[model samples]
Target: MKLWKRAAAAIKDQKSLLAVGFSRRASYRNTDLEAAIIKATSHDDSSVDYSNAQRVYKWIKASPLNLKTLVHALSSRVNHTRSWIVALKSLMLLHGVISCKVPSVVGEIRRLPFDLSDFSDGHSSLSRTWGFNIFVRAYFAFLNSYSSFTADQISRTRANLRSDKVDSVKQQLDRIQKLQSLLDLILQIRPIADNMKRALILEAMDCIVLESINIYGRICSGIIKILPAAGKTDAARSLKIVNKATSQGEDLAMYFEFCKGFGVSNARDTPQFVTIPMAEVEAMEKMVKSVEKDEQKQEEEVVEKAIVLLEKPRLQTIITDKWQTFEDDEYCFSEKAIQEYHQDPLPLVVSNQPVCYTMPDLITF
Candidate 1:
């Protein structure tokens, strides 16, 4: 049975290689992208192919339009494969692509082109590979959510940056909360049962660790922005976020510990926990109160000014109905004076002949 399986796999590999060799068309620049994708997601590869995955990411960076081809190729490979290994590998490759953070790529991948929500392994029975099937589904869910989350973050960042006003504390807090939710999702991507020690799963975990670090950084950045600018009303929410951030920090520390136990190398470099002083929160609240008091004082000053204006005597003018006359010279020139002053050059002509008038007699009834 093993021999037959090996022979079948070898034949499949040969056919895949031939297809890749012939796949160099207008859609791709060269055979490298196609070959890289194939090798990176190959079932025969005992471990994740980081090189090919990175290569694919570089191609995406060089030309984001290549995403269409990448999506099609990945979809075809993953959807047709019955092996959990290939599915996970393809997903990991896609995960690496998203890590590039290109605007176009992030925008385009806001929703995945393919579906894996109901993926089931065909190579093995339901009883044997159910764990893997679940793992793939969980991983897919995370990726889907992660893509949308990233796109939203990018859009909000661009909008805030373009605006004249500082980004609102509410918006910043919202972003942090989203990151927290994503972190929860990240925590749920653990390998199940016998697949716990698999190198490929560990690779995926490593990628997850990197993603966690990125999210943590963004959260820290958001907190920093919120702390100084937050008002009393916002300070309360900001405090909750701070507390949540601290809790999330601890959660991350524990998560790293989990990853370290699970053998993800990147977790070894997990940063220290985030801690915010209550003094800062108090300062923000006090500042908002002082600002409000100043505004009230200004309003009182304005009212006082208005009252003073009302108390002072107002100047009044009386209107008369009497008529007055002015000399013609002081006003308009008379019509006769105008005509005499500006005479016409042409002489007036008068008819010397006189005509007799005739009238009809009225009849009396």
Candidate 2:
């Protein structure tokens, strides 16, 4: 049954590819680009057609306008596909295109053109294909977030290049925290079942491992650079980040171990673990304490200043008369005069007739 479904999907993809090849709506070159995308993300997922995928990447890198065609073709193929193979391949192709780091592609693809968060595989029963479904969803989530991360990273890089100033410790730490978040998302792409050892699954897992290494390395480099400057920023915030990095290092270790056991070649060579020294953590703690103390001292000093200002004698004009004198002499008053004035209060005029003020009942234009 699986073989039959695979064959049908391949036939359908080939027919669609041929139809796109003959279509005159787009330029011949764009048609070819769309064809390449179709081929790269076809249902036959025994192995990824990286050649065709790279070709698409080259086309996009050459001219960013090709991205519109790419997005349309990739979205149509992925969104309409029921086969897990095609969905995964499409995601992998997108992942590669993003990896090319073409500024235009990165900026435009910050959010995916298609949604796969609720993707379900139709090639097999849900019970059997649940792992693939999870993998696809997880991969989609990571790619979506990672694309945004890449776009942001590129924007920041360009901004830094344009300016004479380097990124501050807070900026660096924020980037590291974001990379750590991406790592967490990538790590969630693990196979849910031991039987999910197919080449297609392994291929996707390999890519995940590679991305994890890249993100994890950047995170470690960032941590190293920012650790020395911890005192320069909010120490408590810095300390929280340091603790997360330490925990992420452990999670990454376990993630790679799982990858190696699950047959990812890249995981066999373990990346260097980031070890935040106890002394550094202690120093950060002390900085945090010192920061807290300084803030408390500032508050106390402000309070003391306020108290001293309050206690100090200040010249104040004293108005001995309780009554107020206005421009009208009749309104002038004194306490004793106020009592006499109230005793002989002015006469009140009471009108029994109701007087209504007319506001234009219906205003004319």
Candidate 3:
């Protein structure tokens, strides 16, 4: 049988795709692990952090891993990206080796505390907690906004962007300039220091908190569903809500511009649309306006019904109690949920998942 290098395993002359990670050194003769640790400590790369890798290496050499502290530190990717990555690499590699060396210790890691409470909604970082609920929610939003990730979708999206045949030379040049601006923005984003990842983490965490703490999302969804104005408001509201879907909307807009070579000069979050025939645009606009008018009338009726419902003491009490629950420190992803999770557990988490709490698509909203 042909000998192939093992994936994600520390090997003698193979590079790991992960951050500064290598297997435990079997012997001095087998220096694969040793070499990776040394490289990580001294150098920077697209994958590994110099210092974080070194610290991880130190822990590995000592044995009896500090799995709790190590895992906890992975949360520091908010500020220390490369360094955090190095630590992560080291943690995974050391854990792999340590687990095999002393299998009994593996169970102990499962008992370790996981901090998942980072509810930072694009404004500030929140504390960490140990839950995949938030992460699942963020994943849903990302998936919705990132519909262009696939080759098929990308092709279709690009096909949709058509420049007018009667466009003037000035328009063509302006389009090229806009395209170049998108490229520049991309360069800034590519540096990773542009806070792209941090923004995503914060935004993802924020989305969960925003949805959990408020009835706004539910209200919007309800309005779209129950109200007659839904058909009209759906477009505007969906655009607004779906606009918030991707944390990387700006980047995506730029990407679209890049791919289509079409001019996109609108705000980062707003979608850019290629102009269609004037008559088609007018017809669509008229339809949207008519729909909006119907939706407004429907919302008024809903408000009237809601006022009647609120007049009932029982319904008012229920609403008050529901709102009061937010005052408690005990929040989403309750202990009961965690216990249930143990029974029907998700797959073992690898990489960061953003470490998984900031799990955005839990139940697909």
Who wins the TM-score comparison?
A: 2
Report each candidate's C-alpha RMSD, comma-separated, in the order given. Answer: 15.9, 9.6, 32.2
Model 1 residue 181 distance off true place after TM-score fit, in angstroms = 0.9
Whole-model Cα lDDT of every candidate shown, in order: 0.78, 0.84, 0.36
Q: Please, what are the lDDT tens digits per residue for candidate 2 over residues 6-125?
A: 788788988998888687795524888898999888888677888998899889999988988998898888878888888889898888889987787788778888999999988678
| Model 1 agreement with the true structure over 205-288: per-residue lDDT tens digits | 888888888788787777776788776667667777777777878888888888887788898867764556678866766766
**lDDT, model 3:** 0.36
TM-score of each: 0.70, 0.78, 0.21
Worst 10 residues of 3 by lDDT: 1-10
| TM-score of candidate 3 on Cα atoms, chains taken together | 0.21
In model 2, which regions exceed 4 Å deviation?
27-29, 273-280, 295-365
lDDT of 1 at 216: 80
Off by over 4 Å in 1: 1-7, 20-32, 160-166, 281-365
Q: What stretches of model 3 exceed 4 Å from their correct place?
A: 1-38, 41-234, 241-288, 299-365
* TM accuracy, model 1: 0.70
